[model samples]
Target: MENKQLLEIAEQAKENAYVPYSNFHVGAALITKSGKVYTGCNIECASYGGTNCAERTAIFKAVSEGDKDIEAIAIASDNSSKNEITAPCGICRQVIAEFALDIKIILGYSKGDIKEFKIKDLLPHSFTGNDLI
Candidate 1:
């Protein structure tokens, strides 16, 4: 799907975020190489560390659907006042790196700001499943 469409999906996903802890709602959308799109929102847990990020949730959902080869991802957050729109975290990056290194990542903000980059751009020289070989 087009980045614009993916951004729309991410925005919709954000509405489903269950973030009572930090109150930072985030959403993610992943498009598979075969043209299927999957979306997810951040789910926060009282345990803090048990929280799951929108990026990982979307990626996991895509993988579970047998979309092992991801093409692109978009992340959106309405909490732009406190933080700028950015890519996935180290853990999410590594998880994405496992399935896709050349995947495109679209970071979106509430104020109409947007950023785009390949997954490799966020995690340069990252250790992936290839590292196990």
Candidate 2:
């Protein structure tokens, strides 16, 4: 599927975010190598530590379903400007690296205004599982 289509899904998914604390709603759509798509929204918690990011939510869903060959993921948020397109947080980035090293990350913006990047570009010289072993 096209990146724009995936982004559109993410845009719609953001409507389900449960962010009472930050009010920063975010959504993500992850597509696997087999073309299956999983969608997630940022789920905030009162304790904050229980909060889960949209990217990780989607990725975890895919992995749990035994679909770890991630092809790409698109993220969308309530950013009104192109300059503020949402990017994955640090924890989300590491989770993505654990599943896919060559995944494409799409930053969705006001329709048609999107940015794409390789996961490596987002987390340069990343510390992967290999570092631990």
User: TM-score of predicted model 1?
Assistant: 0.91
Model 1 stretches astray by more than 4 angstroms: 80-83, 109-111
Query: How well is each residue in 25-96 modelled by candidate 2, as lDDT tens digits?
Result: 999998998999999999999999999999999988988899999999999998823546888999999889
For candidate 2, which ten residues in a row score worst on lDDT?
Answer: 78-87
List the pairs of residues colliding in candidate 2. Answer: none
How many clashes in each structure?
A: 0, 0
lDDT of 1 at 65: 76
Scored by lDDT, model 1 comes in at: 0.84
What would you estimate as the lDDT of candidate 2?
Answer: 0.89
Instruction: Point to the candidate with the largest TM-score.
Output: 2
At residue 110, what lDDT does model 1 achieve?
39
Off by over 4 Å in 2: 80-83
Q: Which candidate's lDDT is highest? A: 2
